[model samples]
Target: MRAELLKPGVRPREVWAWAAFDFANSGYTTVVLTAVFNAYFVSVVAGDADWATFVWTCVIALSNAASLLAMPVIGAVADARAEKKKWLFAMTVLCIAATAGLAFAGPGTIVWASLMIVLSNLAYNVGETLNSAFLPEIAPESSLGKVSGWGWAFGYCGGLVTLGASLLVVTQGESFGLTFDQCVAGTMLITAFVFALASTPLFLWLKERSVPRVNAGSSTDSSGTITGAVAESFREVTRTLKALPRYRDFATLALCGFLYQCGVSVVITLSAVYASAVMGFETADTIFMVFLVNITAAIGAFLFGYVQDAIGHKRALAITLLVWLAMIVVACLAETRGMFWAAANLAGLAMGSSQSAGRAMVGVLAPKARLAEFYSFWNMALWVAAIVGPLSYGAVTWMTGNDHRMAIAVTGLFFAAALLALMPLNLDRGRRAAEAAD
Candidate 1:
């Protein structure tokens, strides 16, 4: 195997351990967000209410919105005290618990389910931001694409394992005299267990590398009180926002990420719904399809990392965006089941490469000292996409009298616009600015 380019004091095992968190966390996202729980929430838990899809989007969007205000602050705290692992662990535990909590929801439990989603998704988002901050600490700048791609490709494998396991449980539960609902609930508990078990390596091996500062904006003192840290987090955020113009390419990248990720969020949150509602897929078929798509996504994520490094992050991302637009067009026009499958697989390829490329761009753009804090803003962008994308899909579906294909067609604009926005992002300028900051 080729050796990875890592920073001083960073071990390959430590990097692997860091990547393992993606493996652990993918279970929650694959099972809870994309493949199973979303469909379950709409068709089963909500008892097929005409408004279930809209309600699901509203609850998740509200959850994303609520957490949006707190993300930068959380990032600042982690940076202030080198507390990324601490916060990451806390969030991981809470998300696992909250995912398990989802198992308890059934008919007449809409409020219960929504509450769990808010709690779990918030924790998941925060933990993800913290986890990503470790990338710049561990990998060299030149190899960011491959390293990020490694994590993403590895993560999709994790998702595949968890999804495959969940599929077995879900498909077999009914044979054991369990209702479909009980089968799905059982999968949640299974996902939680796997998530907890797989993540143990991260805590044992990943070390915090940041030196503490009271505030990243101005303070040099490392021993300041937590209250002061919290107060300065806000100030630092303000400073960053005002100074964003200084890093024009990074700002532009964030905007493009926001727009593209909105489309991604729609796919993540609503694809299962679309499969069942528009394409007539059963729960098993949907899970299996997701499983297959994940395989392609893993391949794309792995191969495209080298591509990103070779062609540049901007070019690599633009290629993926083209794939995304193609996926959207194919899906919008698809009538037969086989045609839809081709589109979904295309989406899977774009999904994996685009996300990894975007993340690596952030790592390139962010200064070393402010990894967590800068990545927090990136996380914030994702949450904004989460809110806008799914809600827009839901709105279009509602307004068009449940015409889901039209909703998907409208979703294509996000990718188109993002590609246009990405064309002007100058990576060399961004990298020079980031090195200066460091």
Candidate 2:
């Protein structure tokens, strides 16, 4: 491979432009999806009170289920047509509209909030599906880890910055700061606008390539017109899954990813609420802790990119998983804010490493022609794992009636299982290179 082609297909300007979308859009997941809005909706806005947890769980389950149902079909269609950017743009718009709708959600509007969240999550999943599909088209396989790491790094940067602003506005308690309601509404509106604006350049810079073995007429209707797109997408999904079994490593990696993501998503998703409600930390303190984690996560992503290129993906992933398990163990046993911060730091280091390395490993293992389809399967597993995490956490909390610490401890077991499953896979240097070339 030439050194020139190892770089992203778009110029540096375009790469930054593309990455900014991740930076901008991540505010929704970081602040609204995981941290700020969730706590507010459950604790403050949902008045039927005891039913709050159940409502959030149902929304997550339904949203992830919808994404899983849609992702493969969308992936196959995008792969078949090689039109990732168009799909990406469409999803971005849908997400923007959904997020904007959240601005209307206020006290006693639990139903509206849940509907908007589901729609927002669906759009987030679709946009991520298309964004990931474009990775192989832009960067050479040899440099994929680095390029993907850059995106993660920027994403964390965005999360931290926007979340910092949210902290300032929400925790100020009307001492020249906006009320909680204003903060929530402002966050929603600004997040939507920024995400939509940042993603525009992707549609301009990305170039499409043809997919091998895709039927030219398959995306259209039976009358030789371009109707029934949804039905066509579903049929293609069926075709893709039937052929997926032949990809052994891809299948194994995806299963491992699914199990491991249960731990990962729970940590990020519940960190703020756990800190504030369980540990007796103030909301401002929780936000600061979140900032610390995001900073460490950005650094971890870059460092692990090097590790993935050097020591190998499976080993790097195993190392991170061990750290993750250890962190959870320590976190569960701790009693003070100091101990909690220490655990958060440890988790932050391992968090980005696991995700970036896992995805890079998938990039190497998947068949080049079916990259989009395989990645969609991988993403679906991730969201499914995410859904399981919160539901399980809520269920365990309700049953044991113990501290949230038990939920953290239980998530550790999943990480350990993923680590054990991955230990037997010997992905040596020569093998990884060969896989990448394919």
Candidate 3:
């Protein structure tokens, strides 16, 4: 089946160009959202309010909610116009500008910090969706698993590289005659610069394979104007949502993705918080730890790409999901910092593999003609998960008197539910459904 789906014309450099966007954007999440800025927001920007953590989660949730609303519309519009690359670039620009805006936020600037986070994160999430939508258009079906894993591996390496740089600035900037404030701001500007520099190859090299759509989702002629196309896109999104169940495997897999992705989101967004608030790790310790974990994550993503194809996507994702469960248990049981560190590295392994597998599953399952629209739905699931997972953690910690152990334990439910759902997913049927649609 994959042999038949395989096509020529995918250049290795083009593939790398696509992957470099992942590399480009990793610094934003790693430095701003995950490591430096989040902790800074809670402790400094919010003046150490008891509600600071919850408020930070609120900002994240709000941004994801915005992404959830706008992603499908944006995808549909880009699909109709065959302007995905343009939209991607626009979002990237917005994110970079917003990230730079964050540099100016300081103590007693809660609203300023919140606003920047919302804008930057919203751009980041939408841009990520657009990037995922490119996979089916680029990689042949036979290479989907490998290429998807390859992209994730690149992404982790990007995280490591950017985080490594941030670590140096944080640790050595004082010696270089930079104040703490300047170092933090410098890191943000550096991330913005790296994102722009790394993504240049993508714009220059990765060709847009999708032609203009006749459907309202893509073509302005169908709707008669860009505004009309936008309106039609909203309608198409509605229709698509109602139509999902007809493709049982795709729908089921999306559901499973929604569930597990929630767990993944929590892990990514809150791990640093947990490290600091629970395990007593400082900024430097968390950065260094996450740096090491990114190494493990890259290895896991690269090695598991072959394993995914050798076994199957479903089985590969299952293995990763189970690992997530084990990771949670380890985190919960850890009485010492060293034990918690083990759990974090275990999480790194699961994080990259599961995400790669999930991505490949979508690439294989989405209809050839409506790749962007379908990916938008999947991306919506991820945004929704982003909101639900981390927000729930915040709520749990808030209600439980900041018991991070309990918060993390609750996150395991998402993965467990996804595992149960995976048992019934028919990947072959899903692939056939996609082909039939095409």
Candidate 4:
């Protein structure tokens, strides 16, 4: 770690810029993935509840799987070239463009809607990986947890704003002489605008600090073709995977992350659907519920961030997972809207805490030289969970005639398995190992 980054005098502007990226992209997650567009895709676009759920899961799973393969290579290449910021900029532009394109999707445009979402989501995940790679460079190890929490906390605020705006548009579109479909499409455009406009601070203020590492065998040839670069990236990823066993604590943490995120992924991706299908929430009600959750989520991220730094990363994560477990049970058993709302609040707290703690732990456990590569693996775990969680929920729902409660109960098992995986994690030993590697 650099002396200046370790000192209390680290630039506030740089930290804010880094945090701003989270604020920027979170609009997409709030509007497109979680709150507005997803329900629109299912009910209006696809026009079939069960089939829409299946298609939604398939889109999420396929895009996540594709990104899972691409991220490690992208991270390896960025780390070798010391170009995290460059890649981040490119991915951000793609995400914004794809999100903007969603405005063209309307009734009977299911295929177009799915394609746009997949592309935008893929770019968003890539950008997320690159953005997290900057953490160690921007903040000291001592405050990494706080910084990570602040980013997520800021992100929830962004989500809250975008969701609130979408709710207004969704509810009032007809009064303004627009159809419901037009209003939904317009919300997508607003999300893209929010993402692009808010992300400017990151591009303007955050500097890339990692130096390029050009190995003789890995450097591009005089022809300037990316073929060699691509090959080198795959080789680097392979080398890192092979070396994982040597970093026992980091590897264990990765497994724990993968397991817990399965449940987390299901909760975030399908909570709206659950409200609609299981609890009979209309579009406005679902959006309002998500808006409420975002408020509490911001508070949780802000508070639990310091909790992780004060106690320890693993302990904080364990506590959050327990919260998730309880919430899942509550959600499954809830017979009324108010009961589900209670579960959503708990989900909000666990959601923020788990993400903040997981990111901080990865920053703490990874050797600085391979920070991007490690975060790539961190993304892989989440993507893998993305695959299993949604697909399982979809499969169970489809087979059981849209019985979402049973599928939700299955999600709780993922959390329980994750807690068991965390039993052996030793944060102090992991920190020592990372420092030794440095």
For each candidate, the alpha-carbon lDDT, in order, equals 0.88, 0.74, 0.86, 0.87
Model 1 C-alpha lDDT per residue in residues 1-438, reported as the tens digit of each score:
245588877888888998889888888888899999999999988887778888889988988986787777677777876788988999999999999999999987999999999999888888888898899888888899998888888889999998998999888888889998898898899889989998999999988888887435343245556566667777778877886888888899999999999999999989999999999999899999999999999899999999999999999999999999999999988888998999999999998899999889999998887777788888788899999999999998888888899999989999999999998899999999988987
lDDT tens string, model 2, 1-438?
A: 244634544566556666677786777787777667777776767852655655666687788888888776677667766667777888888888988898888898878888998888898988987787666666776777777777777878888877777777766647866677877777777778767766777676655654544464655424433345566666666765665455556667777888888888777667766776678776567677878788998899877887777776777888898889889988998788788888998888898788888777766766677678768878988988988877787677666663577777888888988877775564454245335546
Task: lDDT for model 1, please.
Answer: 0.88
lDDT of 4 by residue, 1-438 (tens): 244534355577878888889999998988888888877788888886567898888999988988988887678678877889989999999999999999998778878888998899999999998999888887888888888998999999889878888889989989999988888888898899889988999999888889887572345435545767767767767877887876788889999999999998888788888988889898889889999999999999999988988988888999999999999989989999899999999999999889889998999899988899888988888899899989998888899998889999988999999999999988788888888888
Candidate with maximal lDDT: 1
Q: Could you give candidate 3's per-residue lDDT for residues 1-438 as a string of tens digits?
A: 233333467677878899999888988988888888888887788876778888988999999999988886688778888989999999999999999898898889889889999999999999988998888877777778888888888988888888989899989999999987777887788888888888889899998888986544444655366677667778878877787876888889889999998989888888888888888888888889989998999899988988999999999999999999999999999989899989989998998899899889988888888888888888888888999998999999899888889999999999999999999998888888888887
**What C-alpha root-mean-square deviation, in Å, does candidate 4 show against the real structure?**
2.0
Model 4 regions more than 4 Å off: 1-9, 220-224
Mark the regions of model 1 whose C-alpha exceeds 4 Å error after superposition: 1-4, 214-230
Models 1 onward score TM values of 0.96, 0.91, 0.96, 0.96
Better of 1 and 3 by lDDT: 1
Task: State in Å the error of residue 307, model 4.
Answer: 0.5
Q: Evaluate model 4: give its TM-score.
A: 0.96
